[model samples]
Target: MRAAGAQRGRVKRARLADVDPSLIRPALAGLVPYEPGKPVEEVQRELGLERVVKLASNEGPYGPFPAALEAIERATLELNRYPDGGAYRLGQALAERYGVRFEEITVCAGADAIIGYLSLATLGPGDEAVTGWPSFPSYVLDPLKVGGTPVRVPLERGRFDLEAILAAVTPRTKLVFIAAPNNPTGTTNTRAELDAYFAAVPPHVLTVLDQAYFEYVDDPDYPDGIAEYAKAGRRVLVLRTFSKIFGLAGLRVGYGVGSEEVVTAIAKVRRAFDVASVGQEAALASLGDHGEIERRRIANREAMALLTQTIRGAGLDFAGPAVGNFLFVEVGDDAETMHGALLRKGVVVRPLGPFGAPDALRITAGTPEEIDFLSKTLSDVVPAFR
Candidate 1:
């Protein structure tokens, strides 16, 4: 019996080695998985520290709005059943809020998930999708996952270079993703730039405007994505998320507004019941809680200002006055080293190595105390790194 088992194990190993890796999609093999914010538990376990501050992943540190808790409690009774795949009520709420038709909306688990649906529905082998680097990685990853070529235009002065992106476009270009108050840098393109960009892009090329931090934006020139949809000619989609200012990052609810055709194509490949029942309910409830949203938004702005001041006082280089609820600070050579030092010190921040900014780190805005802790840790640790 021992000899027979040994023979079976050998045969299994040999058979596995015989399968050609080339059979797998060529783009998928080396693809590194997305890294989310470091969980509190993981850090505590790693460092043997009871106290830690996690300011990564750009998530609002606040809990769900009061009304959202009620919705979650009510939805708890329906856990046995699948969520409404159509997301009728959520769709209706968003449509009414934006003054758009119901057919133009498609609710998904997150804006990142909508990117997945877009990739599955539109991208194909040899197709090209364009986006700015030092920005969201998903825009590049999603296209590659579908065997589409990703054309990354480098940011000019920490912002999207629209002209360069347009110049890079070819007949094979199928999609473009623009993240407003773009991640890492957190700067925005003006309304004039987007208008010019829309005009330059060909009708065959679809554009996705990711407004994940829309509610935090206070800039007068920050173009409204819902309004941008009206200006776009052929193919355009606006993405918004509940993960940021709505303080529902755990629930993973996001939505898109676009042409009926784009919505239809994405829906064709959309994962059914993607958004949870509780997530949908919480999102709907939060939308009506405008007072809470405004309060949180105002609070975030104050916290951001405090952090920016600290960054300046420490003589740290940073992108100025971000519209989003985060700041990008330059930490000199080998960001991973600095990142490790901070991790050891019980403060968590996102190193931008994967985002192509190895000299910098992105920090999500936290409360006054949290920001002060980060600033102090950074001041102490950064000198050692230098």
Candidate 2:
């Protein structure tokens, strides 16, 4: 029996090796995989350090709210059953909050998943998706995955150049991804800018407004994607997630509010039971806790201010009035070296080589003690880099 098993394995290996490379999708050519931040466990294991603080992924330092914790506990009892494939309850909650109909809400595992679904549903060969570069990697990647071209407009002054983005739109452009409070840079597009974009953009394009860090923004001029576009009857899909301020990154729940037609199309392409039962419950609970959201928002603002102050104190420069949970610090040409030094010091921040800025790093807000440790560590290591 063992000999037969070995023979079958050998045959399988041979067949796999003999398979034609041409069978692979041509769209995948020259595409690099997305590089996420290093996990806490991996960092600890590699460095043999008992303590490590990760501010790499832009996740909140806090865990899920108390109500969300209870929701998770309750959800565990029904583990034997499958999750709601449509994520109906969570979708309903989001719909109510956004003042959109339930049919207009499309729930998915995360904002990334929604991007994938939108790409799959709307893009194909010879199609194009326009977006700002260094915003979200997924905007560039998802379109390529669906055999569509990506048109990248470079950011002007660390923020999306709305005029440049509009100029880039062609007749073939089916989607335009606008990352509000863009990742890495954390700068936002103003209401005036978005209003002009909506008015001028071609009718063929479906605009995707990604507002994953919307809750953290205090600027009164920062436009709410839903109120501005989706509710106001424009061809827009607004993407948001519980993964940011809500402290439910592990649960992987996010939602989109769009027209019923667009949401229906996305539903056709997205995976079944994309968001798990526990995630749905937790996200629903998290959505209802406005006070907790405000608390986290204020705390994040304070931490980011401290981080910025420390960076300036070190005689370093960063981009923003960053409205998100992180700062994009310019670490000089020695960013790689500085990153390694911080890693050795048991602080994990995101290196921006993949985001096309090799001279920078993204540091997120952490708890007070973590911030203190990071501040001291930065003070110790930054002078050498500069």
Candidate 3:
């Protein structure tokens, strides 16, 4: 009987190698998994260091709003109960806050979840989702995961080539994602540019404007997609999150405002209790904390300026405007080498090689001391650039 069991195990081991790879969906087969920012705890654990400054992810260093913290505390008692599947109260709050119809609003786990919903709601096999390259990784990955073609238009000098994006549209194109103040690049389109792009977009296609870092932006030229969506009466979705300026990254709450019909379609496939009770309460609390948002915004601007100036002083050119709480600076050395050197110095930053900027690094705008440490660390590690 033991020999027979051993023989069965051997047969299964041999069959594992012979198993058909086609069992997995072909679209997702070649898809590269998204690489998230390095966690602070991970660096500390790996390097056996107690002080690790993680400026890899563009998370705010000031922490979440006090009210949001209190809300989370208040919500702990309700953990046993499942959250409202419909998210009725939070949905209503968002609608009133954004001046959109209550039916036009939908809350989800985050912008990433909403992106996935958009992919499934709009895309099918052979259909395409158009977006700018090096903008947001999920903009491409989400559609590809759902067996849809991703049409990537290369950026124009670290900015979206709106004309090229429009030209890339085809009969199979069901959606287009515009990451305003685009990720990794930090460049944004002006009001005029957005107006022209929206005017020319075909009515058949849905344009999703991802404004995850909207509050961080202070540029007068930047166009507000929410206002555009409200006035244009087009098939548009504006995605915003409490993650960035609100310092609610851990809560994972975000919302989308769109045409009621489109919101309904996306809501159909939304997972039950997608946003947690704690998350919903925290985000709702965050919306009312304008003072915290403004304070963080001001702090971020100061930190971003300091980082950008330091990079420029080092004779490294940033790819675009440092509109977000991060700067994409040309390392002037190998990205991996600088990344490793900085990692050794307990400075965790993100390499832009995965974001198609092989020569650049994305450093988040952290606290003043952290920024000073990074500035000094860069000078020591990449002296040639300095």
Candidate 4:
């Protein structure tokens, strides 16, 4: 009996040894997984700290709008059943808000999830997707996940170079991702630049405008992607999120607006019930309160101003003309060192190593009290690095 058991164990070992990595997609080779900002709870646990202010992720410093919280609380009771796979109510609300047809909208887990749907629906082996470097990693990542080539156009002055993006386009290019009010840098492409982009870019390529931070944008020249694209009547998908200004980052609700055909294609590849019931409810509630949206937008602008002032007072170099809820500060060669020091002090900011800027930090505009704490922490820490 012992000999028989030994033989069986050997057989199992042999089977395990025979497993090949090639069984998985070849595209995953050397792909580093996306690293989100460290959570507040995590820092608290690791360091045994009582208070940790997380300004790492570009989430709103405030909680979900009061109405949204009420919606979420009420919706929790309905969690025993699966979510509405179609996300009908939220879709209708977004369609009405954007002035687009219901068929033109597709809801997702988050705006980032839409990128996957686009990649699955459009990209194939050897197909090219063009995007700006250091903008959003998902723009580059999703294409690579589907065995597609990613053409990375370097940003000119921390902003998307529309001409360079146009130059990068080839006949093989199938998708283009433009992050308006781009992450990390918080810079936006102007109306004139986009008009030039749309006019010149070929119709065969699908342009995805990721407006994740659209609600917080106060710049007069910042183009409304949906309105502009609709006027052009081209292959365009404009993505928006409830995560930023709506303060529903935990719920992961986002929607995309495009032509019926484009939205249909993206929806076809999406998972059923990709968004949660509570998330849909909260998002729906968020849209109903337009006044709250404006108030939060105004608050975010003031917080961003305070953050800018704090950074300037510290005598640090930074990138600007930023209209989003964050600032990109140059922290010298030892950015990792500075990042660690700040983390120890219970203040969290995004270090841009994976975003390809190893010498900088992306600091979100946190609440006034949080910002004050961060300011004091930076004063203590920056002198050492400087």
What's the lDDT for residue 70 in model 4? 94
| Candidate 3 clash figure, as a count | 0
How do all models score by TM-score?
0.93, 0.94, 0.92, 0.94
- lDDT per residue (tens digit) for residues 40-97 in model 3: 8877877777788999888889777899889999999999999988788899998888
- Write candidate 2's Cα lDDT for 131-225 as tens digits: 99787888988999989999989999999999999999988999999999898888888999999999999888899999999999999999989
Off by over 4 Å in 1: 1-23, 231-234
Please, what are the lDDT tens digits per residue for candidate 1 over residues 208-248? 99999999987888888787654344368999999998889
Give the Cα-based TM-score of candidate 1 against the true structure. 0.93
lDDT of each: 0.88, 0.90, 0.85, 0.89
Q: Positional deviation of 147 in candidate 2, in angstroms?
A: 1.3
* Model 4 / residue 262 / CA error / Å: 1.7
The residue pairs found clashing in candidate 2 are: none
Question: Of the pair 2 and 3, which is ahead by TM-score?
Answer: 2
The predicted structure with the larger lDDT, 2 or 3, is: 2
